[model samples]
Target chain A: MSRHLLALRQATIGDASESIAAVLDQLAREDPVGAQWLRSLDWAELRRLAAERALAQAAKTLACPLQKQYANASQYGTESGDPPKGTCIGVLVGGDTGYGSSVQLGVAIDGQALSFFWNVASQEAASGTLERMRETVRQAFREQTRILMLELLSEDGEVQREQDAAGRTVLRATLVVGGGAR
Target chain B: MTTKGTITIIAIPKSAEVEVHIDLPEVPECTRIAARMQAVLACLGAPLEDIQDLPAPRQRQGVSHAMRKRVRGGT
Candidate 1:
């Protein structure tokens, strides 16, 4: 997998309100810690924060899975055949809450498979937890693959609950792959 | 808006590569910047599959606070 960082600066001169809000939104998404603190402040304080420094909301995309897999295919009998059955993609969504003080992390998939995993943490300064975030991402991928419609080998469908709220636990649903149209 | 201070970094595992994206100026542009990163990923063989628009999160105010306000009758 290859990773790259793309950053752009956006500054709105005349009406600082719109520009400030936009920057705060991006910051909340990128830096949850900083966002948490920002959330507690009133508009005046928020504007002050905006005026102090330009917001930098950075996000990363994990890619290039196939190219990396082609080499190890010999071991898995993945040679010269059906051209990689599926695509395994992963992403990490994070940001500051509009309040500009709290940070939130959400991880989900593309299809009907909607899995939003989030955690609210303090703004120990505007930043993301790299290691923790990566681990969750890997888990998401694993969950997606196991639940793939066709990958079921036995009657082993399980719903794992990571957290519970109001007597309801957040479910990590798996995709069932591999039945060839059944 | 400028992205000077913030640095966007992508870490590729297999080839052990790291791509850096820097935003110039003071403020950062979110959408356009995201698009540029998508372009870089497209080149690195990670084209976006499809964009799924999820519902926005709704803010939840405390019910107890609302109840208290109702009882006080605009105190």
Candidate 2:
């Protein structure tokens, strides 16, 4: 069975507001045609253009079938219980700040099945825990376990917990793969 | 008056994959922008299946807090 993990690094814009302004300015100075095009857009038109760019960027980054499979599996739901064994790939993205900062991870083993987890937390703790989650994925890649499990861990090596709430860190780890082993 | 805010788009990749988050000025503007974004996603070959509006950080905290309480209360 083949298992793969594709990690898309966070974009390096420090502040979205500032970055957008700067990018627009740069476009205007360096590419007058593009700047003029942008300037001609209504507010709604500009937003549509932005959305198109973001989608195109993500699509380019996830060109591989495995990555696409994993992404599909992560977002959709499947029947309850373990997935039939075969080749399974999981894709997860997590971070403390920005849009969709809540911890969301999805694994797709078979073609149509998906298992997902969402955890909401304070910004400070969410950021730290997301780093640990990435490490966990790396470890899973190294170990090649048939079943993968991960816990949100703090910097000090203890299981992480939401600061303002009473609950242990939640990590629901299960992989589903349909069809015969590959 | 023109309303101003940010919008984030997350692509979900099934038949098509895109999620949108809007913080625009007015409801009408938000609706118009969202429809336009959907069109863009379609042109990009990944139409949107779901769209979500992300709340501001402070509002998110409140929602999360409430959710945690509900979970704890076993509702």
Candidate 3:
């Protein structure tokens, strides 16, 4: 149970971007057809799609924040004739759990296989546990996304997207949790 | 002395000993989040994992007190 409280002032933009992209790719492969379908939807429309699907609960959990305080104090006094005094100091701080979709991707629904992927991802994004989280990761194809989708595919094709059986499209959302407490 | 790490465990009564690691950077906050995560895990009756707090400075008590007050008020 390792933990870190980092006030990272834009120190890990690359990591965040990479993670965001990785998550998108994961969602895309997990449900290819659904990802294709979601790719066809507009970004705003996809955001609205999540909104329509009880987004508040997911939003709350993913937006966890935290704060802490540290203090080191000492006392100084003398018994002999002299003025008496004491010293005290403290540090106060605040930060977030770094969990939320910083960036979003549009997903398109192409077939049933893709549909299951989207449904699962959306469920996980909104209310997913470690088990679901693990399954989602397992289902996503990371390397293929970078080499197959980014290097080869056109800009219009690559997006943070996923789809479901009902032709329902959803965009992949980025969720950031602070690292260091590993 | 150079920065060092710490381990703080907050356990539930009649339950297993839950251990959390508090990296030197965010010891207290790691402690706080670990505590919250522990509660969340317990409520769900789920197995726990070592949750890491992002690297940063220690949290300030004054702000934390204010935030706690706000949380209490909100609830």
Candidate 4:
């Protein structure tokens, strides 16, 4: 499985523009018809994921508050979107992930699809799709020797975009083991 | 260290094996994921040529925790 983790090493958290665009794209899909490409994502020759709770479910999600209008996060608030036609795909019992230092992961969702403002107060789970279409080559490199792993846990958490001790728009979640998408 | 490109496979449990480090061009994350998955499938005894041609996965994203039937397709 380390090789699988190695595969995650090359992936970064995605730039703020990509993150914001993804948020918009997902939310727009929830809107009435003809509002698909509110944010343009190249679905061609791309590798993507759709999970039982995307948007913010796998790995931590990022939003540049300085670029809020571009973020299109107003519609969904801070908690973020979920898989349409959903179900409870995961139930994490707040515990510790035992891994050594120096392994990092940055996760995001990008595809020709959408996420929505889910009325999940009563729904126990969410649905999603994960797609891996092809491979690509760009220009980048890092001087490191080791391994990294990425684990996509959940996205649709109940968020309170308040300030931490340092006063940044930090996200904190209290996840339920076998409960609704709260 | 050899000058020629090489591929190595190690025996493991039910999981995939580690591959030789192919110092290729910049690739990973947004791309190469499909290629990595292809490698994994290949480790499982699937043909390489066929794995290379798999279409984008439209498979429904269903959770495997606390559920009965597999959930497919979402709103």
Best by lDDT: 2
DockQ of 2: 0.02
User: Which DockQ-derived CAPRI band holds candidate 2?
Assistant: incorrect
User: TM-scores for chain B, in order?
Assistant: 0.34, 0.50, 0.31, 0.26
| Interface C-alpha RMSD, model 3 | 19.0
- In the range A1-182, model 1's lDDT, one tens digit per residue, is 22211111111111222233444465567654434443443533222222111111112232212111112123222232111222112223343443321222332222212222232333412355533444434333322222221112112444343433333223332222123311
lDDT of 4 by residue, A47-85 (tens): 222222232232222220111111112232323222222
| Pairs of residues clashing in candidate 2 | A110-A177, A110-A178, B10-B19, B12-B17, B12-B18, B13-B17
Superior by TM-score: candidate 2 or candidate 4: 2
DockQ of each: 0.02, 0.02, 0.01, 0.01
In terms of lDDT, the poorest run of 10 residues in model 1 chain A is A5-14
Higher-DockQ candidate among 2 and 3?
2
lDDT of each: 0.27, 0.29, 0.25, 0.21
TM-score of each: 0.18, 0.22, 0.15, 0.15
**Angstrom error at residue B58, model 2:** 8.7
Model 1 Cα shift for residue B55 (angstroms): 49
lDDT of 1 by residue, B2-75 (tens): 11122223322322222322222212232333333332222211222222322322222311110000000000
Q: Across residues A15-46, which tens digit of lDDT does each residue of candidate 2 receive?
A: 12222334445545544443444344343332
lDDT of 1 at A163: 37
What's the lDDT of the predicted structure labeled candidate 4?
0.21
